[model samples]
Target: MTDGPIITATGVVKTFGGLRAVDVDKLEIRRNKITALIGPNGAGKTTFFNLLTGFDQVDAGEITLDGQNITGTPPHRLAAKGMVRTFQLTKALAKLSTLENMKLGALHQRGEKFWQALIPGLWTRQERDIEARAEAILQRFNLTHMRDEFAGTMSGGQRKLLEMARALMTDPRVVMLDEPMAGVNPALAQSLLELIKMLPAEGRTVIFVEHNMDVVQEISDWVVVMAEGRIIAQGTPAEIKSNKAVVDAYLGAHHGEDLSKVELA
Candidate 1:
């Protein structure tokens, strides 16, 4: 295993309208592992995401990636440093072709300058290499055939796949997904689940927020359960399944008693 956690949060807190949403005292994302963030509605998972990604400012806390303090860096800069995330809803470019959308991700890459190309052979070659890499990624996602199609014309599942493919265009170390299974068909949901599971195999720290317990249990190596804007439980999938607090918060306060009574009767 790697030596450092890919992401860490200490005393992360954020509030809106005088209501505290996320009260995670501490959180850690270990290197090269699949971590699931599961929570009930209104639990502030998205709020926490916004703060950590710089989409929202934190009132008090610290967030670090790979031991580097990146508490308040804007999203673009954070992405440049290999911290990237996919939206709960696919925010793909409606008018752009899928291939063009992937190409946009390569614009921020190093060594693509006019000066670098003035060498007569280097920069042009690198640009061409980027195109080839994008093509390869599209193929990997089974999107090569749709590369020329406008993003708006694709089905929701295809768009989700495209979004995931686009995130890879940045060569990130940490990939965060906000409900990767949302808006996807069952077949595509299965595919998305498999893809998320495969993320850590490639050495990227995978953290995803999802409410679908079946998908979470099938794919996640570690589960973090949040409720009422606080992390109430963290454990493996099986452990999370039996967590009384998680059941009460998500299912109902009487969930365990009902289940136990049913079992005994």
Candidate 2:
């Protein structure tokens, strides 16, 4: 933890026609630490992520990364600024090979321009470097064997790994993961959990939304709870577990129940 927050949001609000999806007054993500955003279904956890990452427009709010205002910044621009995110549903391109998907995560490719596309000398070396970096990341995630496989051919858990690996292609300072443990197998889930816990150690700030309390307790350095479009509490996993407001809002009747026995979706 640091003296200042890495990411901060104030007076943030989002709506969908008749529904108020998010209404956060204040939220701060600690630097170089893992923060878990937990809430029940329809609590606007993912919606808040979309707003922060610029995947969706917010109805009203201000968001800043490392003291620079980034409200309404486009997703690619945010990535260039060292803020990257992975989707809950795993947005791997099905038609692309795993390696190809990873290459797409690299920013500012010279070959992307029509004129530069015809000049191999302008981009070939850079392309090779990008490929090398992607391969190294693949090895880190233990997906080198599937580098040539189509992302669609992978199982749900594998796709999650691919998504996280691709997000690292930007070399982001802040990584936001939405429901990372969702739909993963037990074996892969454990592996993913370890990878996530290691991010802060590498000097990257991590803010993840997770429904599984056990996973939250195991990995998060800080926890924020939300319900009915508003944050109900914020604290350590132990403090959050004992928070009366959190219990009444998200934890519900499970107030006294063992958290390890509670299954959240």
In every candidate, how many clashes are there?
0, 0
Task: Provide the lDDT at 101 for model 2.
Answer: 97
Q: Write the per-residue lDDT of candidate 1 for residues 32-66, one digit (tens) a residue.
A: 89899988898899999888888888889999988
lDDT of 2 by residue, 1-265 (tens): 2569999999999999888789989998999999999988888899999999999998898999999999999998999999999999889899999999999999999998999999999999999999999999999899999999999999999999999999999899999999889999999999999899889878899999999999999999999988767787889999988876777666466654433344432
Among all windows of 10 consecutive residues in model 2, the one with the lowest summed lDDT is 256-265
What is the Å distance of residue 52 in model 2 from its true position? 0.6
The candidate 1 region of ten consecutive residues with least summed lDDT is 256-265
lDDT for 168 (candidate 1): 90
**Over 4 Å off, model 1:** 110-123, 254-265
Give the runs in model 2 whose Cα sits over 4 Å from its true position. 1-3, 251-265
- Model 1 pairs in collision: none
* lDDT of every predicted structure (CA atoms): 0.84, 0.90
TM-score of every model versus the real structure: 0.89, 0.92
